[model samples]
Target chain A: MEVAAFYGFSALAILAALFILFSKNLIYGAFALLLAFLGIAALFVLAGADFLGVAQIMIYVGGILVLLMFGIMLTQRASQQDGPSRHNRVEVPITRRLWGFAIGIGIVGVLAKIIFSANFRMSGDAVSRKSTIKTIGVELMTSHLLPFEIAAILLLVALIGAAYLALNRNPAQ
Target chain B: MSAISIYHYLIVAAILFATGLAVAITKRHFVGILLGIELMLNAVNLNLVAFSRYDSDRLSGQLFALFVMVVAAAEVTVALAIVLRVYGHFKTVDPDKLDELKR
Candidate 1:
Protein backbone atom coordinates (compact mmCIF):
# COMPACT_ATOMS: atom_id res chain seq x y z
CA MET A 1 0.00 0.00 0.00
CA GLU A 2 2.79 2.42 0.93
CA VAL A 3 4.68 1.53 -2.21
CA ALA A 4 1.67 2.14 -4.36
CA ALA A 5 1.08 5.51 -2.71
CA PHE A 6 4.67 6.47 -3.22
CA TYR A 7 4.60 5.67 -6.93
CA GLY A 8 1.30 7.45 -7.33
CA PHE A 9 2.49 10.65 -5.69
CA SER A 10 5.76 10.48 -7.55
CA ALA A 11 4.01 10.20 -10.89
CA LEU A 12 1.78 13.13 -10.04
CA ALA A 13 4.75 15.21 -9.05
CA ILE A 14 6.54 14.46 -12.31
CA LEU A 15 3.46 15.11 -14.37
CA ALA A 16 2.87 18.47 -12.75
CA ALA A 17 6.49 19.40 -13.28
CA LEU A 18 6.16 18.56 -16.96
CA PHE A 19 3.10 20.74 -17.17
CA ILE A 20 4.99 23.60 -15.64
CA LEU A 21 7.66 23.11 -18.27
CA PHE A 22 5.37 22.88 -21.30
CA SER A 23 2.38 25.05 -20.46
CA LYS A 24 1.99 28.06 -22.78
CA ASN A 25 0.01 30.23 -20.43
CA LEU A 26 2.04 31.69 -17.58
CA ILE A 27 -0.80 31.47 -15.09
CA TYR A 28 -1.45 27.89 -16.06
CA GLY A 29 2.23 27.11 -15.57
CA ALA A 30 2.19 28.66 -12.12
CA PHE A 31 -0.88 26.61 -11.21
CA ALA A 32 0.90 23.53 -12.46
CA LEU A 33 3.81 24.43 -10.22
CA LEU A 34 1.40 24.59 -7.29
CA LEU A 35 0.28 21.07 -8.09
CA ALA A 36 3.91 19.99 -8.35
CA PHE A 37 4.59 21.44 -4.92
CA LEU A 38 1.65 19.58 -3.40
CA GLY A 39 2.66 16.34 -5.07
CA ILE A 40 6.19 16.73 -3.73
CA ALA A 41 4.77 17.30 -0.27
CA ALA A 42 2.87 14.03 -0.59
CA LEU A 43 6.09 12.31 -1.55
CA PHE A 44 7.70 13.79 1.53
CA VAL A 45 4.96 12.17 3.57
CA LEU A 46 5.66 8.83 1.94
CA ALA A 47 9.33 9.28 2.82
CA GLY A 48 8.36 9.81 6.49
CA ALA A 49 9.24 13.51 6.62
CA ASP A 50 5.86 14.71 7.66
CA PHE A 51 6.90 18.09 9.02
CA LEU A 52 8.85 18.88 5.88
CA GLY A 53 5.90 17.83 3.77
CA VAL A 54 3.57 20.19 5.60
CA ALA A 55 6.08 22.97 5.37
CA GLN A 56 6.46 22.38 1.63
CA ILE A 57 2.73 22.66 1.15
CA MET A 58 2.39 25.72 3.37
CA ILE A 59 5.32 27.71 2.06
CA TYR A 60 5.77 26.75 -1.59
CA VAL A 61 2.22 26.00 -2.62
CA GLY A 62 0.36 28.34 -0.27
CA GLY A 63 2.68 31.31 -0.03
CA ILE A 64 5.07 31.59 -2.97
CA LEU A 65 2.60 30.51 -5.65
CA VAL A 66 0.07 33.07 -4.55
CA LEU A 67 2.74 35.74 -4.75
CA LEU A 68 3.64 34.53 -8.26
CA MET A 69 0.07 34.69 -9.48
CA PHE A 70 -0.36 38.16 -8.01
CA GLY A 71 2.77 39.34 -9.79
CA ILE A 72 1.57 37.85 -13.07
CA MET A 73 -1.79 39.58 -12.82
CA LEU A 74 -0.28 42.90 -11.86
CA THR A 75 2.32 42.97 -14.63
CA GLN A 76 0.62 41.31 -17.57
CA ARG A 77 -1.85 43.58 -19.39
CA ALA A 78 -4.84 41.46 -20.38
CA SER A 79 -5.19 42.51 -23.99
CA GLN A 80 -5.33 40.59 -27.23
CA GLN A 81 -2.77 42.83 -28.97
CA ASP A 82 -0.09 42.04 -26.38
CA GLY A 83 -0.54 38.37 -27.18
CA PRO A 84 1.42 38.81 -30.38
CA SER A 85 4.27 40.51 -28.45
CA ARG A 86 5.47 37.33 -26.79
CA HIS A 87 5.01 35.34 -29.98
CA ASN A 88 6.94 37.92 -32.01
CA ARG A 89 9.88 37.81 -29.58
CA VAL A 90 10.01 34.03 -29.72
CA GLU A 91 11.27 34.19 -33.29
CA VAL A 92 14.64 35.72 -32.44
CA PRO A 93 17.56 33.29 -32.20
CA ILE A 94 19.39 33.04 -28.93
CA THR A 95 21.05 30.00 -27.41
CA ARG A 96 20.21 26.71 -29.07
CA ARG A 97 17.71 24.56 -27.14
CA LEU A 98 19.59 21.42 -28.14
CA TRP A 99 22.71 22.69 -26.39
CA GLY A 100 20.77 23.21 -23.18
CA PHE A 101 19.27 19.76 -23.47
CA ALA A 102 22.68 18.20 -23.97
CA ILE A 103 24.17 19.99 -20.98
CA GLY A 104 21.26 19.14 -18.69
CA ILE A 105 21.34 15.51 -19.67
CA GLY A 106 25.11 15.34 -19.24
CA ILE A 107 25.00 16.82 -15.74
CA VAL A 108 22.19 14.48 -14.71
CA GLY A 109 24.02 11.49 -16.09
CA VAL A 110 27.13 12.25 -14.07
CA LEU A 111 25.24 12.96 -10.86
CA ALA A 112 23.09 9.87 -11.23
CA LYS A 113 26.13 7.70 -11.80
CA ILE A 114 27.75 9.01 -8.64
CA ILE A 115 24.62 8.81 -6.52
CA PHE A 116 23.58 5.34 -7.62
CA SER A 117 27.06 3.95 -6.99
CA ALA A 118 26.99 4.95 -3.35
CA ASN A 119 25.59 2.44 -0.86
CA PHE A 120 23.01 4.48 1.02
CA ARG A 121 21.18 2.80 3.85
CA MET A 122 18.05 4.42 5.25
CA SER A 123 18.52 5.34 8.88
CA GLY A 124 16.45 5.24 12.07
CA ASP A 125 12.67 5.12 11.73
CA ALA A 126 11.42 8.66 11.18
CA VAL A 127 7.98 7.57 12.41
CA SER A 128 9.49 7.31 15.87
CA ARG A 129 10.24 11.03 15.89
CA LYS A 130 7.04 12.07 17.59
CA SER A 131 6.02 15.64 18.43
CA THR A 132 7.95 16.95 15.48
CA ILE A 133 6.36 20.38 15.78
CA LYS A 134 7.45 20.68 19.37
CA THR A 135 10.96 19.50 18.60
CA ILE A 136 11.17 21.90 15.67
CA GLY A 137 10.09 24.78 17.90
CA VAL A 138 12.65 23.89 20.52
CA GLU A 139 15.38 23.57 17.93
CA LEU A 140 14.40 26.87 16.33
CA MET A 141 14.65 28.63 19.69
CA THR A 142 17.86 27.03 20.76
CA SER A 143 20.36 25.54 18.31
CA HIS A 144 18.93 27.26 15.24
CA LEU A 145 18.07 30.52 16.94
CA LEU A 146 20.46 32.71 14.97
CA PRO A 147 19.25 31.54 11.58
CA PHE A 148 15.67 31.62 12.75
CA GLU A 149 15.96 35.22 13.76
CA ILE A 150 17.83 36.07 10.59
CA ALA A 151 15.16 34.45 8.49
CA ALA A 152 12.51 36.51 10.26
CA ILE A 153 14.43 39.69 9.69
CA LEU A 154 15.01 38.77 6.07
CA LEU A 155 11.31 38.17 5.56
CA LEU A 156 10.49 41.52 7.15
CA VAL A 157 12.94 43.32 4.92
CA ALA A 158 11.62 41.59 1.85
CA LEU A 159 8.05 42.53 2.71
CA ILE A 160 8.93 46.15 3.29
CA GLY A 161 11.07 46.33 0.19
CA ALA A 162 8.46 44.78 -2.04
CA ALA A 163 5.82 47.23 -0.83
CA TYR A 164 8.10 50.22 -1.21
CA LEU A 165 9.17 49.24 -4.70
CA ALA A 166 5.66 48.55 -5.88
CA LEU A 167 4.35 51.81 -4.48
CA ASN A 168 7.12 54.02 -5.80
CA ARG A 169 5.94 56.33 -8.60
CA ASN A 170 7.80 58.38 -11.18
CA PRO A 171 8.07 62.07 -10.29
CA ALA A 172 8.41 63.18 -13.91
CA GLN A 173 4.78 62.32 -14.66
CA MET B 1 13.56 -2.59 -6.62
CA SER B 2 10.44 -3.69 -4.79
CA ALA B 3 9.96 -0.26 -3.24
CA ILE B 4 10.76 3.33 -4.02
CA SER B 5 14.35 4.03 -3.08
CA ILE B 6 16.43 7.13 -2.48
CA TYR B 7 17.48 6.78 -6.11
CA HIS B 8 13.90 7.42 -7.05
CA TYR B 9 14.05 10.75 -5.28
CA LEU B 10 17.33 11.54 -6.96
CA ILE B 11 15.89 10.75 -10.36
CA VAL B 12 12.94 13.01 -9.72
CA ALA B 13 15.24 15.79 -8.65
CA ALA B 14 17.34 15.31 -11.76
CA ILE B 15 14.37 15.49 -14.06
CA LEU B 16 13.10 18.62 -12.30
CA PHE B 17 16.47 20.26 -12.57
CA ALA B 18 16.62 19.44 -16.27
CA THR B 19 13.21 20.88 -16.95
CA GLY B 20 14.09 24.00 -15.00
CA LEU B 21 17.16 24.42 -17.15
CA ALA B 22 15.06 24.09 -20.25
CA VAL B 23 12.61 26.70 -19.02
CA ALA B 24 15.39 29.07 -18.10
CA ILE B 25 16.93 28.72 -21.52
CA THR B 26 13.84 28.86 -23.68
CA LYS B 27 11.46 31.21 -21.91
CA ARG B 28 11.52 34.83 -23.00
CA HIS B 29 9.43 36.23 -20.18
CA PHE B 30 11.41 37.36 -17.19
CA VAL B 31 8.78 35.95 -14.86
CA GLY B 32 8.95 32.67 -16.71
CA ILE B 33 12.67 32.56 -16.08
CA LEU B 34 11.98 33.35 -12.45
CA LEU B 35 9.57 30.43 -12.33
CA GLY B 36 12.30 28.23 -13.74
CA ILE B 37 14.65 29.43 -11.06
CA GLU B 38 12.04 28.62 -8.44
CA LEU B 39 11.75 25.14 -9.88
CA MET B 40 15.49 24.62 -9.59
CA LEU B 41 15.46 25.85 -6.02
CA ASN B 42 12.64 23.45 -5.20
CA ALA B 43 14.63 20.60 -6.70
CA VAL B 44 17.53 21.42 -4.42
CA ASN B 45 15.21 21.60 -1.44
CA LEU B 46 13.76 18.20 -2.35
CA ASN B 47 17.24 16.69 -2.43
CA LEU B 48 18.07 18.19 0.94
CA VAL B 49 14.91 16.88 2.59
CA ALA B 50 15.34 13.47 1.00
CA PHE B 51 18.91 13.16 2.25
CA SER B 52 17.86 14.33 5.70
CA ARG B 53 15.26 11.59 5.75
CA TYR B 54 17.59 8.77 4.58
CA ASP B 55 20.54 9.75 6.76
CA SER B 56 21.00 9.91 10.55
CA ASP B 57 22.50 13.38 10.33
CA ARG B 58 20.08 14.66 12.95
CA LEU B 59 17.94 16.95 10.80
CA SER B 60 20.79 19.11 9.57
CA GLY B 61 19.73 18.89 5.94
CA GLN B 62 16.15 19.54 6.95
CA LEU B 63 17.20 22.67 8.80
CA PHE B 64 19.16 23.79 5.77
CA ALA B 65 16.17 23.16 3.53
CA LEU B 66 14.07 25.38 5.77
CA PHE B 67 16.62 28.14 5.44
CA VAL B 68 16.66 27.63 1.69
CA MET B 69 12.89 28.02 1.61
CA VAL B 70 13.04 31.26 3.54
CA VAL B 71 15.70 32.60 1.21
CA ALA B 72 13.74 31.55 -1.85
CA ALA B 73 10.70 33.40 -0.57
CA ALA B 74 12.71 36.55 0.00
CA GLU B 75 14.26 36.22 -3.42
CA VAL B 76 10.93 35.86 -5.20
CA THR B 77 9.38 38.77 -3.38
CA VAL B 78 12.21 41.08 -4.32
CA ALA B 79 12.43 39.71 -7.83
CA LEU B 80 8.75 40.06 -8.58
CA ALA B 81 8.78 43.62 -7.36
CA ILE B 82 11.66 44.33 -9.70
CA VAL B 83 9.79 42.69 -12.52
CA LEU B 84 6.81 44.93 -11.88
CA ARG B 85 9.01 48.02 -11.96
CA VAL B 86 10.71 46.78 -15.09
CA TYR B 87 7.38 46.30 -16.75
CA GLY B 88 6.37 49.79 -15.74
CA HIS B 89 9.39 51.36 -17.38
CA PHE B 90 9.65 49.10 -20.43
CA LYS B 91 6.01 48.01 -20.78
CA THR B 92 7.13 44.43 -21.23
CA VAL B 93 9.12 41.81 -19.31
CA ASP B 94 10.45 40.01 -22.32
CA PRO B 95 14.17 39.26 -21.93
CA ASP B 96 15.35 39.60 -25.52
CA LYS B 97 14.31 43.25 -25.70
CA LEU B 98 15.97 44.12 -22.41
CA ASP B 99 18.88 45.23 -24.55
CA GLU B 100 19.30 48.55 -22.78
CA LEU B 101 21.38 46.63 -20.25
CA LYS B 102 23.26 44.82 -22.99
CA ARG B 103 26.61 46.03 -24.33
Candidate 2:
Protein backbone atom coordinates (compact mmCIF):
# COMPACT_ATOMS: atom_id res chain seq x y z
CA MET A 1 0.00 0.00 0.00
CA GLU A 2 2.72 2.45 0.96
CA VAL A 3 4.75 1.34 -2.03
CA ALA A 4 1.87 2.12 -4.31
CA ALA A 5 1.48 5.52 -2.75
CA PHE A 6 5.16 6.17 -3.26
CA TYR A 7 4.97 5.34 -6.94
CA GLY A 8 1.87 7.43 -7.40
CA PHE A 9 3.42 10.47 -5.78
CA SER A 10 6.70 9.98 -7.61
CA ALA A 11 4.93 9.80 -10.95
CA LEU A 12 3.01 12.96 -10.17
CA ALA A 13 6.19 14.72 -9.18
CA ILE A 14 8.01 13.70 -12.33
CA LEU A 15 5.16 14.71 -14.59
CA ALA A 16 4.88 18.13 -12.98
CA ALA A 17 8.60 18.57 -13.31
CA LEU A 18 8.41 17.76 -17.02
CA PHE A 19 5.63 20.27 -17.45
CA ILE A 20 7.66 22.89 -15.71
CA LEU A 21 10.51 22.23 -18.11
CA PHE A 22 8.50 22.20 -21.33
CA SER A 23 5.83 24.80 -20.72
CA LYS A 24 6.45 27.80 -22.96
CA ASN A 25 4.66 30.48 -21.03
CA LEU A 26 6.58 31.67 -18.01
CA ILE A 27 3.48 31.93 -15.83
CA TYR A 28 2.31 28.51 -16.88
CA GLY A 29 5.75 27.12 -16.18
CA ALA A 30 5.73 28.61 -12.71
CA PHE A 31 2.32 27.11 -12.06
CA ALA A 32 3.61 23.77 -13.26
CA LEU A 33 6.51 24.15 -10.87
CA LEU A 34 4.01 24.69 -8.06
CA LEU A 35 2.46 21.37 -8.93
CA ALA A 36 5.88 19.80 -8.97
CA PHE A 37 6.63 21.24 -5.57
CA LEU A 38 3.40 19.85 -4.17
CA GLY A 39 4.11 16.47 -5.67
CA ILE A 40 7.59 16.41 -4.18
CA ALA A 41 6.17 17.40 -0.83
CA ALA A 42 3.95 14.38 -1.09
CA LEU A 43 6.98 12.28 -1.86
CA PHE A 44 8.63 13.75 1.20
CA VAL A 45 5.65 12.66 3.26
CA LEU A 46 5.85 9.19 1.82
CA ALA A 47 9.49 9.15 2.80
CA GLY A 48 8.52 10.17 6.36
CA ALA A 49 10.08 13.60 6.14
CA ASP A 50 6.86 15.28 7.12
CA PHE A 51 8.26 18.57 8.33
CA LEU A 52 10.28 19.05 5.23
CA GLY A 53 7.28 18.25 3.10
CA VAL A 54 5.06 20.79 4.77
CA ALA A 55 7.76 23.43 4.63
CA GLN A 56 8.21 22.59 0.94
CA ILE A 57 4.56 23.22 0.27
CA MET A 58 4.41 26.42 2.31
CA ILE A 59 7.66 28.04 1.23
CA TYR A 60 7.93 26.85 -2.34
CA VAL A 61 4.40 26.48 -3.65
CA GLY A 62 2.84 29.14 -1.52
CA GLY A 63 5.54 31.75 -1.21
CA ILE A 64 8.30 31.47 -3.80
CA LEU A 65 6.13 30.52 -6.77
CA VAL A 66 3.92 33.48 -6.06
CA LEU A 67 6.98 35.69 -5.93
CA LEU A 68 8.13 34.31 -9.25
CA MET A 69 4.76 34.95 -10.81
CA PHE A 70 4.79 38.48 -9.48
CA GLY A 71 8.24 38.95 -10.90
CA ILE A 72 7.09 37.71 -14.29
CA MET A 73 4.00 39.88 -14.24
CA LEU A 74 5.83 42.95 -13.10
CA THR A 75 8.67 42.70 -15.60
CA GLN A 76 6.67 41.82 -18.72
CA ARG A 77 3.76 43.60 -20.29
CA ALA A 78 0.52 41.62 -20.37
CA SER A 79 0.06 41.64 -24.15
CA GLN A 80 0.59 38.20 -25.66
CA GLN A 81 2.00 39.77 -28.81
CA ASP A 82 5.09 40.91 -26.96
CA GLY A 83 5.86 37.61 -25.23
CA PRO A 84 6.82 35.59 -28.27
CA SER A 85 8.92 38.24 -29.95
CA ARG A 86 10.81 38.84 -26.75
CA HIS A 87 11.71 35.16 -26.62
CA ASN A 88 12.20 34.52 -30.36
CA ARG A 89 15.82 35.42 -30.77
CA VAL A 90 18.39 32.65 -30.97
CA GLU A 91 20.92 33.86 -28.49
CA VAL A 92 22.77 30.69 -27.56
CA PRO A 93 25.29 29.38 -30.00
CA ILE A 94 24.63 25.86 -31.24
CA THR A 95 27.91 24.67 -29.82
CA ARG A 96 26.83 25.80 -26.35
CA ARG A 97 23.71 23.70 -26.59
CA LEU A 98 25.74 20.68 -27.56
CA TRP A 99 28.16 21.35 -24.76
CA GLY A 100 25.36 21.74 -22.19
CA PHE A 101 23.77 18.51 -23.33
CA ALA A 102 27.05 16.67 -23.23
CA ILE A 103 27.89 17.98 -19.78
CA GLY A 104 24.40 17.28 -18.35
CA ILE A 105 24.25 13.75 -19.69
CA GLY A 106 27.76 13.01 -18.60
CA ILE A 107 27.10 14.22 -15.09
CA VAL A 108 23.87 12.24 -14.84
CA GLY A 109 25.50 9.07 -16.05
CA VAL A 110 28.38 9.37 -13.63
CA LEU A 111 26.14 10.11 -10.66
CA ALA A 112 23.82 7.24 -11.51
CA LYS A 113 26.70 4.82 -11.69
CA ILE A 114 28.12 5.97 -8.40
CA ILE A 115 24.77 5.82 -6.57
CA PHE A 116 23.88 2.37 -7.92
CA SER A 117 27.19 0.89 -6.85
CA ALA A 118 26.94 2.10 -3.29
CA ASN A 119 25.24 -0.12 -0.69
CA PHE A 120 22.47 2.03 0.73
CA ARG A 121 20.94 0.34 3.70
CA MET A 122 17.91 1.92 5.27
CA SER A 123 19.18 3.00 8.69
CA GLY A 124 16.00 2.81 10.72
CA ASP A 125 12.27 2.38 10.49
CA ALA A 126 11.81 6.10 9.87
CA VAL A 127 9.92 5.30 6.73
CA SER A 128 7.16 3.79 8.80
CA ARG A 129 7.49 6.25 11.65
CA LYS A 130 5.49 9.40 11.90
CA SER A 131 7.58 12.58 11.69
CA THR A 132 5.68 14.81 14.01
CA ILE A 133 6.31 18.54 13.83
CA LYS A 134 7.32 18.47 17.44
CA THR A 135 10.32 16.28 16.81
CA ILE A 136 11.45 18.52 14.00
CA GLY A 137 11.22 21.57 16.25
CA VAL A 138 13.28 19.89 18.89
CA GLU A 139 15.88 18.81 16.41
CA LEU A 140 16.08 22.19 14.78
CA MET A 141 16.59 24.00 18.04
CA THR A 142 19.08 21.54 19.40
CA SER A 143 21.95 20.19 17.35
CA HIS A 144 20.99 22.11 14.22
CA LEU A 145 20.57 25.47 15.91
CA LEU A 146 23.43 27.17 14.18
CA PRO A 147 22.24 26.34 10.70
CA PHE A 148 18.70 27.15 11.63
CA GLU A 149 19.65 30.59 12.82
CA ILE A 150 21.78 31.07 9.77
CA ALA A 151 18.91 30.17 7.50
CA ALA A 152 16.77 32.73 9.26
CA ILE A 153 19.43 35.36 8.83
CA LEU A 154 19.79 34.40 5.20
CA LEU A 155 16.08 34.78 4.67
CA LEU A 156 16.04 38.17 6.34
CA VAL A 157 18.93 39.36 4.23
CA ALA A 158 17.28 38.04 1.10
CA LEU A 159 14.08 39.85 1.95
CA ILE A 160 15.86 43.13 2.55
CA GLY A 161 18.03 42.77 -0.49
CA ALA A 162 15.13 41.86 -2.76
CA ALA A 163 13.12 44.82 -1.54
CA TYR A 164 16.03 47.15 -1.97
CA LEU A 165 16.86 45.96 -5.44
CA ALA A 166 13.33 45.83 -6.66
CA LEU A 167 12.47 49.23 -5.23
CA ASN A 168 15.46 51.11 -6.50
CA ARG A 169 14.47 54.08 -8.67
CA ASN A 170 16.22 55.28 -11.77
CA PRO A 171 18.74 58.02 -11.03
CA ALA A 172 18.93 59.28 -14.61
CA GLN A 173 15.29 60.28 -14.50
CA MET B 1 9.84 -1.86 -11.19
CA SER B 2 8.44 -3.03 -7.92
CA ALA B 3 9.72 -0.16 -5.80
CA ILE B 4 10.98 3.36 -6.12
CA SER B 5 14.69 3.29 -5.52
CA ILE B 6 17.24 6.00 -4.91
CA TYR B 7 18.23 5.55 -8.52
CA HIS B 8 14.70 6.44 -9.48
CA TYR B 9 15.03 9.77 -7.72
CA LEU B 10 18.44 10.22 -9.27
CA ILE B 11 17.03 9.58 -12.72
CA VAL B 12 14.26 12.09 -12.17
CA ALA B 13 16.77 14.60 -10.92
CA ALA B 14 18.93 13.96 -13.98
CA ILE B 15 16.08 14.48 -16.38
CA LEU B 16 15.13 17.61 -14.52
CA PHE B 17 18.66 18.89 -14.65
CA ALA B 18 18.83 18.16 -18.38
CA THR B 19 15.57 19.87 -19.07
CA GLY B 20 16.70 22.84 -17.03
CA LEU B 21 19.83 23.00 -19.14
CA ALA B 22 17.71 22.91 -22.25
CA VAL B 23 15.50 25.67 -20.97
CA ALA B 24 18.47 27.75 -20.00
CA ILE B 25 20.05 27.30 -23.41
CA THR B 26 17.01 27.70 -25.61
CA LYS B 27 15.10 30.42 -23.82
CA ARG B 28 16.22 33.94 -24.66
CA HIS B 29 14.24 35.69 -21.96
CA PHE B 30 16.04 36.48 -18.73
CA VAL B 31 13.15 35.20 -16.64
CA GLY B 32 13.15 32.02 -18.66
CA ILE B 33 16.71 31.40 -17.68
CA LEU B 34 15.76 32.12 -14.11
CA LEU B 35 13.02 29.53 -14.32
CA GLY B 36 15.53 27.02 -15.60
CA ILE B 37 17.82 27.79 -12.71
CA GLU B 38 14.94 27.19 -10.31
CA LEU B 39 14.32 23.80 -11.89
CA MET B 40 17.94 22.84 -11.45
CA LEU B 41 17.92 23.95 -7.83
CA ASN B 42 14.80 21.89 -7.14
CA ALA B 43 16.50 18.89 -8.73
CA VAL B 44 19.36 19.16 -6.31
CA ASN B 45 17.00 19.58 -3.37
CA LEU B 46 15.07 16.47 -4.41
CA ASN B 47 18.26 14.44 -4.46
CA LEU B 48 19.29 15.70 -1.06
CA VAL B 49 15.95 14.92 0.60
CA ALA B 50 15.83 11.48 -1.01
CA PHE B 51 19.23 10.54 0.35
CA SER B 52 18.38 11.97 3.75
CA ARG B 53 15.43 9.62 3.77
CA TYR B 54 17.51 6.48 3.20
CA ASP B 55 20.52 7.47 5.23
CA SER B 56 20.95 7.11 8.98
CA ASP B 57 21.98 10.67 9.62
CA ARG B 58 18.52 12.01 9.97
CA LEU B 59 17.69 15.59 9.08
CA SER B 60 21.10 16.45 7.70
CA GLY B 61 19.95 16.37 4.12
CA GLN B 62 16.70 17.97 5.09
CA LEU B 63 18.60 20.72 6.84
CA PHE B 64 20.75 21.30 3.81
CA ALA B 65 17.68 21.25 1.63
CA LEU B 66 16.15 23.94 3.76
CA PHE B 67 19.24 26.06 3.35
CA VAL B 68 19.14 25.47 -0.37
CA MET B 69 15.54 26.58 -0.47
CA VAL B 70 16.35 29.76 1.40
CA VAL B 71 19.26 30.47 -0.87
CA ALA B 72 17.18 29.75 -3.98
CA ALA B 73 14.56 32.15 -2.77
CA ALA B 74 17.20 34.80 -2.25
CA GLU B 75 18.64 34.10 -5.64
CA VAL B 76 15.34 34.46 -7.42
CA THR B 77 14.47 37.67 -5.64
CA VAL B 78 17.74 39.31 -6.50
CA ALA B 79 17.74 37.92 -9.99
CA LEU B 80 14.23 39.08 -10.76
CA ALA B 81 15.01 42.51 -9.39
CA ILE B 82 18.01 42.62 -11.67
CA VAL B 83 15.85 41.45 -14.53
CA LEU B 84 13.41 44.21 -13.82
CA ARG B 85 16.18 46.79 -13.85
CA VAL B 86 17.56 45.35 -17.03
CA TYR B 87 14.18 45.50 -18.67
CA GLY B 88 13.72 49.08 -17.56
CA HIS B 89 17.05 50.06 -19.03
CA PHE B 90 17.05 47.98 -22.21
CA LYS B 91 13.28 47.99 -22.90
CA THR B 92 13.61 44.26 -23.64
CA VAL B 93 14.57 41.18 -21.61
CA ASP B 94 16.09 39.20 -24.43
CA PRO B 95 19.61 38.02 -23.67
CA ASP B 96 20.77 38.25 -27.26
CA LYS B 97 20.20 41.97 -27.31
CA LEU B 98 22.01 42.51 -24.06
CA ASP B 99 25.35 41.94 -25.75
CA GLU B 100 26.49 45.46 -25.02
CA LEU B 101 28.00 43.93 -21.89
CA LYS B 102 29.63 41.09 -23.82
CA ARG B 103 32.63 43.02 -25.07
- The lDDT leader among the candidates is 1
Model 2, span A20-45: residue lDDT tens = 55555667777777777777788777
Against the true structure, candidate 2 has what lDDT? 0.73
Stretches of candidate 2 off by over 4 Å are A77-103, A121-126, A171-173, B1-3, B55-57
Off by over 4 Å in 1: A78-95, A121-131, B55-57
Instruction: State the lDDT at A36 in candidate 1.
Output: 80
Mind giving the per-residue lDDT tens digits that candidate 1 earns over A52-106?
7898889888888999888887776555345554532332134656665677778
Docking class of 1: medium
Q: Ten residues in a row with the worst lDDT in model 2 chain B?
A: B50-59
True contacts kept of each: 0.50, 0.48
Residue B42 of model 2 has an lDDT of 77
Give the per-residue Cα lDDT of candidate 1 at B85: 94
